[model samples]
Target chain A: MDAEKKNYGKLFFSTFKLSACTFGGGFVIIPLMRKKFVEELHWIEEQEMLDLTAIAQSSPGAIAVNASILVGYHVAGVPGALVTVAGTVLPPLIIISIISFFYTAFRDNAIVNMAMTGMLAGVAAVICDVVITMAGGVLRQKRVLPVLVMLLSFAAVRFFNVNIILIILICGAIGAADTYLRARKGAGAK
Target chain B: MIYLELLWSFIQIGLFSIGGGYAAMPLIQRQVVDLHPWLTMTQFADIMAIAEMTPGPIAINSATFVGIQVGGLPGALVATIGCVLPSCVIVMTLAYVYYRFRGLTMVQGVLAGLRPAVIAMIASAGISLIILSFFGQRELPADLSGVQPIPVLIFCAALVILRKWKVNPIYVMAGAGLISIVVYSAF
Candidate 1:
């Protein structure tokens, strides 16, 4: 009980710091998180942290918020996830409140406009990085099905205009079958 | 009445926001700009820039910003709760499922299939941004006359540096902004 309470406190403050320092949200939370929780705190193992981050991104809502839920849940269960979510959301909420009051200044300033416009490219780059990093991981698994699914998913959205929901559903079916077949094969081999 | 609208719209946003991140952007655009007129296209763009510049999830920031614009602190609270509630419920459900059926091959297989598909979703989001920044369109066009050289250059350089050096994206973003200032000023 005491341990969980301690973890809750640590999770809150740690996520608070990570989310506060994190800019642009999404998968951006992962590296800062890995540094703090896995490397420093030893709270989660490296592979486990990777899995959590991947799942956090893969699911829904905001990746940063989703990640907090996952890392918090992994570390301390539902309550822990709640605590981390609070930590993650509070800083931005406070900042957004302040900025909204003066949004006119932000909206009108020429320099701000230029900066944001310029940052557009950088934002694209950051996203491309996410794609490469994630796709590279899938490729490295040396598994044909994952690689095939990954490419098909990309084409379906990028070119074919297929609904994302459909893609996800189809992929889920494929993935399940892949896992089932693989397991059966392994069993027979043994 | 507005609070209810805020709550309902954001709940929909949260419910459908499967891959998170930029995955939610189009949905937010649809809700705030197209469906509700809660914010104009320009205003939505501004909020997006602000969201990128700030910390926290884009969805939460938008919910708070939109709520504040439409109502006030109460609106902000309502919209934020709307945004977060689905994430809580969904993540809880999936996490529970995984934990409860950790050994279930069917469950693992479903997740495994979902994994790559999820990555593709993010990739799709990024590609849209790439098209927007480079070609000045949400979707790439045939003419390509609308191409913006500055962002294209920055995108190329930034992508290279990111891949090669593994630099923190914060600096890369700031640097792009700075480049914009100088480049635009000179022109």
Candidate 2:
């Protein structure tokens, strides 16, 4: 029993450690998560990792936090979930607190500004990579219709600035209808 | 009263934003620009640029920046807490529910619909950022001299290689930061 408890604590520690230090947000965290939970610890599998990413994305929260909660709960119940959220949130909270305390000095510094510009460029690249990769995955379904929906959504928001939330709601409706229609067709075939 | 309003607004953001941080951008922009009018588009973009440079989630950084703008330090605290609280509460509750309904078909159907929509949100965010970077500008600069596209290129290259080669991104981020300092004249 003692050994089992120790195991949970260690797993708990590692979960937050990964969460706290994870830069570039959700997609980048995927590989690290798989490395720790699926490969090293065997806590979950690759497919489950992918599923969790979907769940985390669809849920209303920061991706890192949602992922941490899901993984924490998976590993050691509610306590683990609590610890993971704490772990993920602690670093940001501390860093932001420090920045808030000395914000004026930090904001006015030229060196910091320069560094920030470079960092923003880097962030854009990271976000770009995510979009391209996910787009590729979506395209692989070999269904042109969803591909068109995705492109039109991009065009609408990017060029027309038609409000993304509305696009998402529209696409979601289409997806639901697609699923229902397919299910009905399958039932008819049976 | 203002602080309470700030807190509630962010909590609404946290609870309803279905596609994580990136997806929250448009809604957040609406709040910052249309409803709250705390920051202009330019300032919001600048703050977003700053958040990208720092560690942690962009949404939290956004909350901190906007909060500070609205009510100084106290506003930042309220906004940050508000941004996180709903998700934290919801996730905890969901953890319990997830265990019980791990095998239900309705749950499965909902997830299937949710997944692609999430991806769509991320794509939309990327587009939003791109628009924010270069939208409705009157004059193109005579030269690309003020902006060093090289650093951005190198950073992107490093990220692609890191993702492709399975390298540690922390080392990559640290290395990029150091390289940026030495390679450029601190702008």
Candidate 3:
């Protein structure tokens, strides 16, 4: 029981540190998480970490939080999930709350405004890089279906302004139907 | 009443926003800017910038910021809880089932479809942000006359630096901030 408590503590602290230090959003957190959990701590295996990331991405909510919950649950259990969530969220809550108090002042400050203007440009560039890398990954796979789905999704969002939720549901249904048909075909062949 | 509203709004955001935090931006804009008048478009863009710079998920950071703007500390708590609740429940449930059926083709196919869609959503979000950065405060079909040249230069430079050098995004942002400060002071 003591060992288990210690394990949970370790899980909580690691998540806390990871969330606090990580910038550039969810994708940036994954590699750092692997280093801390898989390489340094040996708390989770490499393969498990990959699976957790995949599930985290596919599941709802923030990938960073989801990934943390999976890793925490794997290491401990429900308690681990709760602790890690707190750890993952607390940093931003505290930081943003402090910023909130100074929101008006920050808004009025000319220097700060200038800096923010510049940062917005930089952020746009970073996001563009993300777009290119993700699109390249899909293209490299050379699968017609995924490529089609990607382009369709892009057009739906960019041109039609389709609701994001509806798109996800439609894609999910398509995926399920495709999988069911393939499974049935396999069964027939056997 | 406001607390409950915040909770419901974010719960929807949390539940529907798949792929990652960036994918949550449009949902957030719809809820905060369109459905509710909690924040103006410019303020929403600012929140996006702040959320990106800060540590943690963009969705959580956004929730906290929007929650504080709409309510107070209590509101922040409520909104954040609402935002993360779906994640905890869904991830925990999926984790168990996924481990059990790790080899299932059905699961793989669902993920395969979801993955690219998520990427497209993220790319769409990036494009919107780019528009906001260049046009500044105006919506789509922005007036070219109002376009700021310095930000355009900064955007191109930052993109080149990031793509060629493989530098961390934080440094690029910091450098841009410094350059802007210097330029503004000089002018």
Name the top lDDT candidate: 3
lDDT winner between 1 and 3, please give it. Answer: 3
TM-score of 1: 0.79
List ranges where model 1 is wrong by over 4 Å: A1-14, A24-59, A70-81, A142-144, B1-5, B12-48, B69-71, B93-108, B135-142
- lDDT per residue as tens, model 2, A38-84: 89989887877886766676667788778888888887777777777
Tens digit per residue, CA lDDT, model 3, B1-187: 8999999999999998887867788789878987899888777877887887789899999899999999989989999999999999999998888778764467668867777888888888777777778888546663578778888999999999988998988889889889989987899
Candidate order, DockQ descending: 3, 1, 2
Per-residue error for B120 in candidate 1, Å, reads 2.9
Judged by DockQ cut-offs, the docking class of candidate 1 is: medium
What pairs collide in candidate 2? none
Off by over 4 Å in 3: A181-190
Write down the lDDT of every candidate, Cα atoms only: 0.81, 0.66, 0.87
Once model 2 is optimally superposed onto the true structure by TM-score, how far is the C-alpha of residue A137 displaced, in angstroms? 1.3
Error of 1 at B37 (Å): 4.4
DockQ of each: 0.59, 0.36, 0.75
lDDT of 3: 0.87
> Candidate 3 residues A1-190, lDDT tens each?
9999898888888989999997867877899999999999898888888888888887889989999999888888888999999989999999999998899899899999999889888888887887788789999989788899999999998889898889988888888887788789999999
